[model samples]
Target: WKIEIFFRNLKQNLHIKSFLGTSQNAVEIQIWTALITILLLQYLKRIAKHPWCLSNLTASLRLNTFTKIDLFQWINEPFSPPPDEPEIA
Candidate 1:
C-alpha cells in the first residue's frame, strides 16, 4: 500500500527505526515532526537550482548545519564559497 511506501521513505531518509517515546501523544509528535521535515526537504529540493537527489541534499544539510552561509545560496550552489562580508567601519 502507499502508506507502507511512505513509512519506508521516512525510515530510509530520517533513520527513524524506533519511536523515542512510548506514549501515544509522543509517538504522534515524533511522526509529525518527521513528516514536516520531509515536506521542508522536498520544498528545498524543488526550489534549488542544482539537481540534488534527496539523500544527498539531506546529507549536505547535516554536514553544513553549523556553517554561516546564506541558505538559499548554499542550496542553489552548494560547492561555492560563502559571499564575503564587508569590513566593519
Candidate 2:
C-alpha cells in the first residue's frame, strides 16, 4: 500500500526510528517536521538538473548545509565551484 511505502521511506530515508517525546504535542511536531523535510527534499529532487536519488540528495544537503554557496546553482551543478564572496570593506 502507498501508506506503507511512505512510512518505510520515512524510516529509511529520514532515519526516524523512535520518538523523542512522549507527549502528544511533541509527537505531532516531530512527525510534522519530518513530513515538511520530505516535501522540501522532493521539491529539490524535481528541480535539480542532475539526476538525484533521494538518499544521496539528502546526504549531500546534510553535508553542505553549513557551507556558503548559491543553493540554486548547487542544485543544478553540485560539483561546480562556489560563488565568489563579496569583499568586506
Candidate 3:
C-alpha cells in the first residue's frame, strides 16, 4: 500500500496531467518521456542500494548536478568511476 503512495507521488510531481498534446504522437512522446525518467530514477536508486523513496533520490541528483556523482557507474561498474565524491572537490 505504501508503494502505491510512491507511484502517486511521482505521477503528481511529474505533472503528468498537464501534458497538453494535441496529437497522438505528441501525447505518446510525453508519456514515454515521463516513464523513462521514472525508470532512470528507479535504476539509480536500485544501483545505489538506497532505501529512500523516489523523491529523495530525485532531489539528491538535482542538488548534485554540479558534483561528480556518476550515474553510469552503477550501470557499468568496470569502466566507470567509483560511486564516490567528486575529485575536484
Best candidate (score: TM-score): 1
Model 2 bad stretches (over 4 Å): 86-89
**What's the TM-score of every candidate structure?**
0.90, 0.86, 0.56
Residue-level lDDT of model 2, residues 37-89, one tens digit each, is 99999999999998999999998998998988778789899888776788999
Best by lDDT: 1
Worst 10 residues of 2 by lDDT: 77-86
lDDT for each of the candidates?
A: 0.92, 0.90, 0.65
The per-residue C-alpha lDDT of model 2 at residue 78 equals: 88
| Cα-based lDDT at residue 82, candidate 2 | 74
lDDT of 2: 0.90
* Candidate 1 similarity to native, TM-score: 0.90
Angstrom error at residue 30, model 2: 1.0
- Residue 72, candidate 1: Cα error in Å is 0.4
What order do candidates take by lDDT, descending?
1, 2, 3
Q: Candidate 1, which segments miss by more than 4 Å at Cα?
A: 85-89
State the displacement of the C-alpha of residue 13, model 2, in Å, after optimal TM-score superposition: 1.3
